[model samples]
Target: MSLTAAADPMLPEPFGILRKRRELSDTFTLELEPLGGHRKFAFRPGQFNMLYVFGVGEIPISISGDPDDDGPLVHTIRAVGTVSDALRTMEPGGAVGVRGPFGSAWPVESAEGRDVVLVTGGVGLAPMRPVIYHVLTNRQRYGKVVILYGARTPEDVLFRKQLEQWRSRFDLFVDVSVDRATGRWRGRVGVVTKLIERAGFDPHDAVAFVCGPEVMMRFSVQALNERGVADERIYLSMERNMKCAVGFCGHCQFGGQFVCKDGPVFRFDAIRDIFSVWEV
Candidate 1:
């Protein structure tokens, strides 16, 4: 009944590729600056863009660069599908069609003055990157900032250098864990949930933002609950089969809502009931 797509939100504009770096064996981080006479892409913390590769098709990739940048719009994508693989093979000076900085975002401003807890699993850290930068840049506004990250293996970790830099800051606390570890791995080996036991924060004054596999979020919420965080203060980013970035296609529908428009970011209390429903 309700439509969220704009009259021509389907149109994709050309963006010039500025840089591309291989992040993992199958993943890449692309830096794109809008080329159609526009200098910047206005975006918030959790928004995403519909990246189109000429004839291959399009996919929704979350914005991974700082929202403060004007020229380069960065997106880190995994080469797991046809469209994405094509995008990955593109070189600098290549072209990509971009549609949006759509969907809701993490409540970064509301987090001001409160102790913030950021929990991420695997590539989930990409979407949470902007929020982390915001907190660090405005370090004086918030209280304690804690980051707990988990990956499939030590080699699977994203933003390794940035994580270390953040860890070096005396005011920020970062803990990383891997599900599988090799002989050379010296970090904690387990799920992200394990880090919660050692997490330092006032459960009553803390707000947490979690993103990852839905199963990971499920378990994270349980752990946060045991730590005394209320459902309303816990947030999550949901993934659905988004076809039309504007929500015309029903591929991204969850329950009675469209993840494209309603959210990719939502409070845990708003979607907890539907989270366990496979059909949602």
Candidate 2:
């Protein structure tokens, strides 16, 4: 509950949209700078913030910017509801409020010296983007880096340019797949889990991070397990109903754990008991 930097967790600090880029038809990325001469916002990778759009409402969004970068705070948001829609349409120079950086973080430092495999789908990649940046910036810290991504279609891919750039890097392994193909599309056509079988990594010594729909995550976990990755070495980012990022509200409760406070990122084995429970 006391994980945020705000003096009062309930109050939000002012921030202005420095720039906005549309990633997809319904999703957009916002680059926000502190307003009123405030200090730069810092947050660990995988942590999220409560974004407040005045006269509308607030919603929790994961931090997508690089943790080591001293620049605007970035959030890739999908316009699913009223608040998020407002945020997506707001132009540059528009004002918004920020309240968090709540929840757990990916074990980037611990993965050093071991292979790192990232499995994500659709917008889920936003939460994992920070981790990718961290690994690439400190390339020598880890043994191998592999990224497996999936989308509904070729056009649904997020960060297309960045993914291409990462794919070109000799030190990193990037593979993309889609459920269906479209015009001029020529790449793997299947779920992301298929790539795990051919991916070159020491499954016994590698750590996997997965973020996506619950069904996709469940399947990805199974695939990783079949590949010999231990349950303890696998992590999942859980995005549930998150109101009141400080945990005052019980919206994000998953069994006995509060995802807003205890997680958002949790080791697979830690929640294995309830991960498959219906409506959990």
Best by TM-score: 2
lDDT tens digits by residue: candidate 1, 226-264? 999999999999999888978789899889778899899
TM-scores of all models? 0.96, 0.97
Give the best candidate by lDDT. 2
Instruction: Give me the runs in candidate 1 sitting further than 4 Å from their true place.
Output: 1-7
Clashes of 2: 0
Lowest-lDDT window of 10 residues in candidate 1? 1-10
Backbone steric clashes in candidate 1, count: 0
- Can you write out model 2's per-residue Cα lDDT over 1-280, one digit (the tens) per residue? 5665546688888899999999999889999988986466889999999999999999999999999998889999989999999998799989999988899999999999999999999999999999999999999999889999999999999999999999999999999999999988899999988988899999999999999999999999999999999999999999888779877889999998889989999999999999989998
User: Which residue pairs in candidate 2 have backbone atoms (N, alpha carbon, C) closer than 3 angstroms, thus clashing?
Assistant: none
